[model samples]
Target: MASFGWKRKIGEKVSKATSQQFEAEAADDKDLADDDEANWVHATKRRKEILLEDCVKKSKELKDEGANLAENKRYREAIHKWDEALQLTPEDATLYEMKSQVLMSLHEMFPAVHAAEMAVQRNPRSWDAWQTLGRAQLGLGEIALVGKQTRV
Candidate 1:
């Protein structure tokens, strides 16, 4: 009976040690999973930032090319370049305003007005946008739309 009791004690001790070891391994796995999730989130944010920077750089280059083209009186090509820039930076009010002016030079009144309106929508405080809008409206024979408070 005494020997049997000692064997039972040894069995309980082994069982407890095995249970503790499993719990410790589970904790380590949970921690590793948490770290992996955190790393993924950080990497995703960095990728987004990189994409934005690339877009901005490309858009700036396109805008400069468009400006040079416009200066040389290549109106259609300038408009195309500006359109490509706008695709990258749709919220750029200046691009829209420039496009509006080019459209006006082409005698495209409706499109000019639309582009100028988009400029104004993007930057309501831009006097250039307002001026372009007013001129485009006038060219479209909508003088009534060009109110006395025209910023231009």
Candidate 2:
């Protein structure tokens, strides 16, 4: 009788262990299925190439307007327009160059130098920005000389 009872207990333990293992395997399979579904959803989304092209076109238009204002000798107004262009595309070296030129025309030498420096910072490959910076520095030097002469 004692032997029979021990055998029955062992059989019950084996059954519970098998049930726990089956539940763990089912959970892992469900997680894998969820991951596959997420991947499929992401693959079906549309790309945004056209929107990017439109932004570039608008930036060019604003830059052209800034140039027109500068050519008309409206330096402050040109700077305002260039500022708008910069707001649209802050990484544009040409817009910064235009702003620097406009500021220089208004005799705002320090601000001109700062704008040129910003252009170089935004695109270090721009020779135009470097030239503008040099010219602005020369203007500042002349102003400094004038101040010294006046002090004498």
Candidate 3:
């Protein structure tokens, strides 16, 4: 009976040791999973920042091209380039104003009005945008006046 008691004690100790080993392994696994998740999140953030930087760079290039085209009096092409720039930086009132100017030169009254309106939306306090809007409105008014005169 004494030997049987000793054996039971030894068995309990072995079972307790095995359980402790399994718990330790589970804790290690949990730590590794947490580390992997943190790394993945950091990588994703870096990728997004890189993409945004690329877009900003491309927007700048397009803006330069738009300026060159406008200087050459290629108003339609300049407007197209400015539109591409705006896609990358939609908040730029300057781009919108430039596009509005191009459209105005082309005598595209409605589109000129719309582009000036977008410029105002991007920056209400922008003097250039306000001026562009005023000019576009004047052009539209002139057309309307002409139509009325013709009808009469």
Q: Best candidate, lDDT-wise?
A: 1
Candidate 1 lands at a TM-score of 0.79
Q: Which 10-residue span in candidate 2 carries the lowest summed lDDT? A: 1-10
lDDT of 1 by residue, 1-152 (tens): 44544334545556887988988999999999999999999999999999999999999999999999999999999999999999999999999999999999999999999999999999999999999999999998887669864624
Higher-scoring candidate on lDDT, 1 or 2:
1
Residue 129 of model 2 has an lDDT of 81
* Ordering by TM-score: 1, 3, 2
Steric clash count of candidate 3: 0
Question: Could you tell me the lDDT of residue 68 within candidate 3?
Answer: 97
The candidate that wins on TM-score is 1
Could you give candidate 2's per-residue lDDT for residues 45-117 as a string of tens digits? 4234555666678888888887887898877777877788777678888788878878888899989888988
lDDT of each: 0.93, 0.78, 0.86
Q: Look at candidate 3 and give me any clashing residue pairs.
A: none
Q: How far is 139's C-alpha from truth in model 2 (Å)? A: 1.3
TM-score of 2: 0.61
Model 1 residue runs over 4 Å out of place are 1-26, 148-152
